[model samples]
Target: MKNIEPKIKKLTADILKDYGQGRTIDKMNAFTSPDMDVVVDILDKLQKILFPGYYRNKNYHFYTAENNLQTLIEDVLFNLTKQISMYLRYLPEYSNADYRTGMERAQEIAMEFLSRIPKIRDLVETSVQAEFDGDPAAFNKDEIIFCYPGMYAIMVFRLAHEFYDLGVPMLPRIMSEYAHGKTGIDIHPGATIGRFFFIDHGTGIVVGETTVIGDNVKVYQGVTIGALSTRGGQNLRSKKRHPTIEDNVTIYSGASILGGETVIGHDSVIGGNTFITMSVPPGSNVSIKSQELHISSKGRPDAEAKDLDQSATWFYTI
Candidate 1:
């Protein structure tokens, strides 16, 4: 055991060293990297804070609500500030400073962000209202907030957007990815979304970093507002790549709207499975017709129905 232990320790120690490869970081400075788990924990706490009665613990008495909330807020603030400081340390700008000095900026940013919680709550409430209004199955705003994946995704995006707006790197992406993993709705923190925006069904939705969405826009599941091309690589960083969605637009499921030059103008109704790459004028009702459709007999995959009737087509009055 002693002989084998020495060999294993040496191998482990060798791999621990950077070896001039930027991929490996030193263990002593491990705290400089953001903690993903802690950031998610912060999100969980923020959720309860954002919607107070929705996640109440029955064990806690009514009189204890304020005290419990206060403690939770303080705990989340401390952990978030620590993680933010660590994230900032990864940049060349903050690497030269001592821990206390580096954390000062983090503290300031965290305080400013916390102060905006009321506004965030208001924005999220409007998003919930949008979901409730858009979905026929949704019973109420409370149900929408509790059950809708789009609402959950939007809530996280709004929080992450605050961090992104404050110019705090890494943490915003972490928050967005956390939501994307849970909700299957990929809304980039860098995306500028206006008030009362909702995504129905929400699964497989991809909203790119450069996408700009105005108020009162509704999108169904499997929607992609993405780039026309990515061959430009890092050369296109911070350049507009995704499409712009104007107000009062309804993009249905499985639709792909690509390119920065592509804009869905106001009061537009984009149909399901539509693939668009060019700009759409305002008040346009875009849809594809004459597409072939095949259906299988009930409970029989081998029995196929003939193509859809050419004269029969689905349409929406916008």
Candidate 2:
């Protein structure tokens, strides 16, 4: 038992030495961890600011709201500045003379990002309306605002997109991934999405980087707008790699639209399980033609052997 302590310590030290090189993975490229727990808390506070009574799970009033909002804003400003400063330390392109300069820049970026909160909330309100309007199962707008995963994911994307535009690396993706964990919908922060976007049954939905989505777009579960190829890897960086979906488009469940050149024109309805590799013009409704279904039943008499469809139709993702 006494000899086991030295062996365990050496093993732990050896493992740390192996992984701490930071060459194989980008984990330790940054100077320090960017306080993701604080980031999550910041997002929660932002959610409260966005929807006061709904997220707090408590009563809302002007007196309490004023104090809380002030305190929360200040806290977010401080913590976000600290996190940004840490992130700025790692970026070679970002110029910083000293710790003071980095801190100042972080504070400036925080204030600027905070100023856009009202606008973010406004845009998200429109998204909530879109969600309510698009989903037939939705009871009310309140339900959409208060209880929908799609709304949560969209809010994260909208908030994180600002940071992405600011050229703040890592944090934006962290924010997006946080929402992804919660909702199972992965929206890259670099994706350009228009106002009034609604994601119905958001699970398994992925919107890739460079995706340009227009206003009033609705998408269902398991839909993916992704790149056709990534063989070029880092060489193809900063290129348009995803599809462009135009206005008033509804992409149904399990539909995969790939390639940067693939444009889904306005008022398009892409049906379930459809695979699109090329562009479709405006006002087109694209659906899958039913293929032959081979069904079998227990041999009661063998006369009922005609390919009778079963209760569940099999689906394949393209």
Candidate 3:
């Protein structure tokens, strides 16, 4: 190969010159920003604390739960507070405040979030039970907790929702994105999800911000409770943009329920592959019109049966 040192030097010079443009993308000063890797590490530690003994690292052995939890909780709080403080220091409102003041506020937020762990756990219990009750394949809660991507996604969502409620910036979304990357389920931390929620075979599920899901709601994979459009962009911020799902509603897989005004009313069953953009009345069963099916044996043109109706009607109550 030809000597490449000159090319490498030129490339380095070009990148350095690009950094001088002063765009946000060119920034990488960790002291001024929270590290994503550290945020993910904090998430891992939080998971270990949330589901004790399940996610314990090989380096740690739990003789008693309290001993392990004490260390784990302290570690999470310290790191969480540090990351929050780093984020707060750069905000416009905190720009004039002393660094210690930002740290104090961050500590307060972290403490408040930690205090709600029991409440979060209670909601998670309901979610696990919902999953077990909603899915025939789920043998037990342990399997759902350890093996289900949906359960893992919801666990992270519950954790991140606490921080989102606390009004801490950046970190909540970072934690949520970590879960999304791990599981193909994208649930916004800002979404208000109710108790006893279940997501079966969850992948390509998008729950947008401003979505309000009621209790006992079960959603299948490829479901999107999202906006009809985002053409308004920031003009629509803090406004209702996603659909509302009332209690006891079962939305099947590949159903796209869109628009702020769209509501899957209570006790409704939305069928698979349905596209909904309008509100449906209570106790409604919404589905696509039945399509014709054809059956034939290979090399038997005379035996072909065309336009066969779909006869199997399924119903669920959860």
Candidate 4:
């Protein structure tokens, strides 16, 4: 009994020591209550501003409209600038001096971003109209603007892309990634996407950095607009690495379009389940056909082969 007690005490002490040394605590610190929610909240406020009456409560009186909007704008600017500054401090790409200067730069960038809100709002309005026109089941623009996850994702991406262009590190990616996590539409912060862009049932979609997508484009689920490789980044850092999708193109589900120099022409229809690495011509239809397979045997056929020869036993192609 005495020996067993000593062994049990040693085991407990070893377990406690291992627990202290394990990556569980590190993971908790890294993942618990992410600071990215600050950026998400800023994006939510921007959404409210973009669609004033439709988004938030329309309680502002005639006299309070300008004053309330101004106050909200200033508050959002302050919080976003502060968060950008904080993010710069942690970004390994920037120096300490850069981090210190980033605060003032963030203020300038935030103001510039705010100034573009009118234009952004116009773009979002057009997108809402597009959604209403595109989806047959949609009741009205309000339902799309308020409830559609795709619209929410696009709004966040557009706002984040503006900040990304202003060279605000980490915060832009954080905001875009938050939208991606929520909507399953992975639009990179550096991607340049134009107005009236629609993502229908957007799941497993990847838009790589440096991608350029034009207006009135529609993408379905499981579409991958990605890079061919990062092998050139072994020596280069700012090289173009994603595909360029022109206007009015529709990429169907499960299609992978990859390459840095791959330019998808305008008014093209990319069919479902197609794998494309090269560029497609304008107004072309790209699709993949299932290959037919035949089975035969020269040796003596056994009972297993006879069983496999039946049409019911053979696996069919999609």
Using all chains and alpha carbons, the TM-scores for the candidates as numbered come to 0.83, 0.85, 0.88, 0.77
- In model 2, residue pairs whose N, Cα or C atoms come closer than 3 Å (at least 3 residues apart or on different chains), thus clashing, are none
> How many clashing residue pairs appear in each of the predictions shown?
0, 0, 0, 0
For residue 1, model 4's alpha carbon misses the true position, in angstroms, by 20
> What lDDT would candidate 3 get against the real structure?
0.84
Per-residue lDDT of candidate 2, residues 61-156 (tens digit): 446767878877887899899988877766885544587888899899989999999988889988988987778899998888778999999999
Q: How many backbone clashes does candidate 4 have?
A: 0
Candidate 3: deviation at residue 264, Å? Answer: 1.3
lDDT of 3 by residue, 19-98 (tens): 99989898868576888998999988887877875788557776888888888888888988889998786568886788
lDDT of 4 by residue, 151-199 (tens): 8888888788887887777888888888988989899989988888988
Candidate 3: minimum summed lDDT over ten consecutive residues — where? 292-301
Give per-model CA RMSD: 8.8, 9.6, 9.0, 11.7
What is candidate 3's TM-score against the reference?
0.88
**Model 2: CA > 4 A from native:** 1-3, 16-31, 57-62, 290-318
Regions of model 1 farther than 4 Å from truth: 1-29, 57-64, 291-318
Candidate 4 runs further than 4 Å off: 1-34, 57-63, 90-94, 98-102, 231-236, 292-318
What is the full ranking by lDDT, best candidate first? 3, 2, 1, 4
Clashing pairs in 4: none
Residue 236 error for model 3, in Å? Answer: 0.6
Candidate 1 residue-wise lDDT at 310: 27
User: Which ten contiguous residues of candidate 2 have the minimum total lDDT?
Assistant: 293-302
